[model samples]
Target chain A: MESLAAVDARLHRELQSRYEALVPVLRHGTQLGGKRLRPALLLLSGAAMHADRTAKNPLTTEESATTEDHVVMATVVEMVHTATLIHDDVLDKATTRRHVPTINARWNDDTSILLGDYLFAQSFYLAATLPSTLACRLVGQAAQKVCEGELRQVLGRDWLDIDEETYLDIIRGKTAELTRVSCQIGADLSGGDEGQVEAFARFGNDLGIAFQIADDFLDLWGDDDNVGKTLGTDLQQGKITLPLIRLLRHDDNAVAMAALDALRLPPEDRLGRVMPLLRKSDAAEYTRKVAESYRRSAIEAISGFAPSSALESLKTIADFAVDRRF
Target chain B: MESLAAVDARLHRELQSRYEALVPVLRHGTQLGGKRLRPALLLLSGAAMHADRTAKNPLTTEESATTEDHVVMATVVEMVHTATLIHDDVLDKATTRRHVPTINARWNDDTSILLGDYLFAQSFYLAATLPSTLACRLVGQAAQKVCEGELRQVLGRDWLDIDEETYLDIIRGKTAELTRVSCQIGADLSGGDEGQVEAFARFGNDLGIAFQIADDFLDLWGDDDNVGKTLGTDLQQGKITLPLIRLLRHDDNAVAMAALDALRLPPEDRLGRVMPLLRKSDAAEYTRKVAESYRRSAIEAISGFAPSSALESLKTIADFAVDRRF
Candidate 1:
């Protein structure tokens, strides 16, 4: 938690600039608080790996990672995540995020786009300050994956046949890739061995997939007050998420055809028609089941690490990834 | 010229990706042929510095830069330029660039924004592959400056008192900064001493300012076909460029008040009113003179280098920066 506080402080410092036009927008974007899941994962992974290594070699005097490195890397991860959220708000035309007006709402789409770009560039600038190009390379590659996945989603907005596998692939690139890179960077910087790094990456990937599924579910069914943002946007945008996909693949032919018809209607009307059908089917339960499966896998991936508070936190995060309403 | 060809090939190769949704947009963005001036400046700076070093020490066995290094750095610079253009098109709502439909026009603003982000990430990924983080640091810093400049321009769209110094500062960040970094990276990678790198950066910065001034001049006075893109966008968008600033500062109080009133008119009508007033005054000549001054300064920055074909090319580019129609 203290490390997360450090990340928050560092993020504010990094966002500071002489450009008065960007300062207010940057503050608003970062202050629209969500769970700092990515940075927390990075810090916890570094702590767990460091503790495991130290436990294994009580007499060895290997140098552990400095708190500065963990804080910097966590800040970098959070910046990338925040940039994507700002751009996504522009694309979705959503006004509020975390119960606050988004950058796009408070400013404009042009400002949102430019602010996202500024944050992205700042992230790379901070990453390059590290002793090696490893962080830069990983963050760059992960950012590319995020864009590719978002592009795929935008292009496939009208498609009616998006299935479970395609949805998984999209989320893997869009959400899971960054989390995977975050954990891997943490483990590697903390001097974890190759296998430990790979294990942490796996944990992150599964946790990220589960997190997105929960997000998709909340967009469909959760209370707006609890979610703290706009809901039903996925349905309005004709974004075929796991629940809709499952509902469309219903066993009853009439139900399936009706769901297809709902998607074909105008965006404003489609949500009303689709929600009732989704509620009648087992789609919500099915979505939760899949999310829980991924959560279990995430927990199992890190089960081999030596028992410590950090390891316990990682497991708790896996549960939170699928269980949280917000 | 062959090196430019190599830069083109490297750019095409770098834009290749597994995402089918992005391929066509990336191709369209990159293939909208601009002058490629940034990459050319980089290559010329590197070559001039290399040739000067070799000539100065014929007996020394100092290694020269490989073609691959030049090509990669040039590609990185061009990618950054191309990315900014795509995003700018969205902000300007310009339908055509280089006589072709912009990505935003052909697809949409969302696609253009994501594609720009994709290219930005790809540029950083490629930069990180180099032997050092120098390129990443410089490019990241330049990109942040660019966004800052653009943001300032957007936020100042309605301000009537934007001065010459503010205009210069905006252009310095939005346009000159990237060109400055391009030359700096080329010289640094090609083994130019620190002083040489700094000199090349100055050359780039001055040339970029001259280039932008020429661009503003052409936007108002040049034929649309000759400019190869939509013109008068700055006037339509209420962008206060250098020429416009000079016009507003004209000694004739009546003319300055008329120009201000024209800017206050609706965008569709303002261009016509402003154009007639601007043509009646010496604003065009003043803009040209300022651009020519920067051009001379750019040329003077590199006059100390030893004589070579690359040096001649740099001077020619400085001339072209101010004088070209497109």
Candidate 2:
């Protein structure tokens, strides 16, 4: 938690710009209260790796002093996530996020776009401060995947024949890739071996997928107050997430046709018409089962590591990814 | 010219995406042929530095073999430029660029935003491939400034009292900063000493300012057929460029007020209303004189370097920055 606090402080510092006009907008964009799940995954990954290594061989004083680097990497990942959220808000046209007005809502699309871009550049600037180019390279690759995923989703809008595989691919890039890279950076920076780093990456990837699946479920069926943001945007925007994809693939031809018809309605009425159908089907249950499976895999990915609070935290996060109502 | 060709090939290679859907969009975004001015600045800076050094001491084979690195850096700067243009088109709502439809016009705003982001990430990814983090840091810093500048311009929309100093600051961040870093990366990567690198940066900064000023003039006065993109969007978008800023500062209050009233007209009429008033004043000549001064300074920035074709090219570019109609 203290390390997370450090990450928050570093994030604030990173958002500071010589162009004073951007600072408030950056702060508003970043300070929207999310779970900070990526940063937590990163810090917990680093701590778990450090603990596993320490149990076998004591770390040098220099090795032990990498908390600052961990914080920096954590800040970098958080910035990437925040930047995506800003741009995503512009695309989604959703006004509120985490019960607060988004950058696009408060300012405009141009502001949101430029703010996202500024955060991205600043993240690389922070990563480049590290001794190696590894963080910059990994973050770059991950961010590229994030954009690709989002682009796929945008392009796939109104795609009636969209399948589960395509949905998974979309979430993998837009959501999971950053989390995977967060864990990768954390574990590798803490001196984890290739196998351990790979394990952490899998853990992050599974967790991210599970998180997105759970989010898809929430968008369809969760409470607005609990979710703290607009719901049903996925269906409204013609995004065929896991629940809807499952609903579409239902064995009942009439039910599938009904779902398709509901989606074809105007954005305003589509969510209302589709919700009742989704509630009647096993789509929600199916989505939950898929997310839980990923959660289990995420836990199993790190099960081989030495038992420690950090390792337990990783396991808890995997559970939280699916179990959280929001 | 061969190096520029190499830079183009490298750029094409860099725009390739694993996501099949993104490849066409990325290509379309990057291939909207501009002057390739930033790449030229970078390559010329590298060549000029190399020539200056080689004149004193015959370079080793390894030293002479950095052409690939120069091309990569050149590609990096050009990608950054193209990314900004993509996002700018969205903000400006420009339908066409380089006599072709902009990504925003062909696709949508969401596509433009994501594609710009993807290009930015890919630029960093390419920059990370180099041996040092210098390119990454400089590019990051420049990009941050660019976003800041654009943000300032967006927030300053229709700001009637915006001063020339404020206009300069905005352009410095939005336009000049990236060019400055392109030359810095080129000179630095080519082993230019601190002083030489700083000199090249100054050269780029001045050239960039002059280039932006000329662009402003063209938006106001040049033929649309010659400029090759939608012109007058600045006034339409309430963007207060140098010419209008000068017009606003005319000795006669009535003329300044008329310019202000012209700006306040409907977006469709603002450009037409402001054009004649601008022509009647000394604003156009004032803008040209200011741009020409910066062009002179850009040429003067590199006068100390050994005279070579590359050096001459840099001077020629400085002249072109102010002289070209487009």
Candidate 3:
């Protein structure tokens, strides 16, 4: 835990200087307060590799791209994550995110959209300068996957007719791909072996899925005040999460049936009542368990990697199953 | 004219395979029958170092990244152009472009926006793969400049406060920056040396400004059928083009004041009428000379380069001042 905190402090310190100039205060997108999970994952893996290097071909402090590479990778991952958030806010017509105005909410859509492009270009440019072709490919592939995920979300909206397999595919593309790449990119860059890279990527993949499902569960069950976003945001937007998908497959209870009916078309202001009805449907518990399963699998994914302090910190991250609050 | 046709033919031949699979509707977008200006500048300069290697570097034949890079750069420049159009359409809310339904007109404000992001990402991913740091830096910087230019446009919009120098600066950022980088990128990859890269970049810079002026002229003077875009689209959007700007500064005529009033606070339906009054004020002729002035300068920028058939072809593109029907 001490090591994790130190690495995170390092990441925050690095991200600070990027704001040397006075950028305008625009509301409505990536307001900079989220889990910082990607950066944490990136730095931890890099730190792990740095430890591994010290045990073998250790650095003489001056030769370190150790922390520097992690910071840039962390910052770059955050940028990719930000770009996705900007676009997703537009798609979701989401008014607020992390308690701040989403870019789509503040600026006219055109400016917000171009701003997203600007960030994406920045991310790519930074990634290009990194030492590995593998890093660039990971970041680039993640970006492409993010776009694909959005398109799938658009196509799947309110279409209860779409299956669980289809739903899982969309979630993986949107949520898990970048997270998986985050681990691979950090480890692979910091001299992690192929085996280590593979294990961490698998861990990230499972964690990303579990994290997203946990968020979905919270959207229905948690207090909106703490979540820092509107309750039933997904349902109002007609996005079907795993819990609802699982619930629909089972009893098809009257309440569940009604919620599904709500998605047969576009939703307009009916969610105040629909939210409670949705809660009564048992979808929340089912979703929580599904998320727990992914968290369990993510922990298992890291088992092949030798037990190290970095692996331990990753276990705490996995313990974030329904446990971490934004 | 014959050379222009040849370049256009070469462009089509190059696009035949990579984007033939693209939806026919989007084909006009990614493969507008423009001269292959950027890649030509690259291939032409790539040959400058060793003319024989020009054959070795047949931009069309080179397999490393030619198809993806060329198409991506082409698509990106067009995407930047399209994002401008989407914003332009929102500002203008005008209906047609290239005589087809604009995204803004075809879809609502929001969808046109996200679609623009989609196109931007697709183009960006293509550019991110080049093996040169210079290429990534150029693309990233140009993208930021485009955003800044648009922001400047939004701010300067009809303050009657814009000066000729400021106007030129705007065009340099909005249009010329991308054009200049396109050539610079082409030159760098083609193995053009430092001096050669500077010459091509200068050529592109001058050409971009000249092209913007010509476009400004065509907005007031050209026939609609030839341009495939509406006449006075800039005026309809309340954009203060060079013609209008010059008239405001120099003309004290009663008609000038009337035109200014219409421009300053334009009527909803009356945007279509400003063109005729603008024409009557002799603004069109003045704008043409302004455009031609830049064209002459652009030709001078090429004088530093050694004479060759490719250089001769490059000159023809700058000659677009008098030759373009639009």
Q: How high is each candidate's TM-score?
A: 0.97, 0.96, 0.83
Where's the lowest-lDDT run of ten residues in candidate 1 chain A?
Answer: A58-67
In candidate 1, how many clashes are counted? 0
**Model 2 TM-score, all chains together:** 0.96
lDDT of 2 by residue, A11-43 (tens): 887777666666678789778748888899899
Better of 2 and 3 by lDDT: 2
Best-to-worst order by lDDT is 1, 2, 3
Instruction: Tell me how far the alpha carbon of residue B153 in candidate 2 is from the true structure, in angstroms, after superposition.
Output: 1.1
Candidate 1: residue pairs that collide = none
Off by over 4 Å in 3: A1-22, A26-33, A53-65, A131-133, A252-257, A265-282, A306-309, B1-95, B104-111, B155-159, B251-259, B267-282
Candidate order, TM-score descending: 1, 2, 3
**Stretches > 4 Å off in candidate 2:** A59-62, B59-62
Interface RMSD of each: 1.0, 1.0, 4.2
What is the lDDT of every predicted structure here?
A: 0.88, 0.87, 0.64
lDDT of 2 by residue, B196-246 (tens): 999999999999999999999998788889888667877777788899999
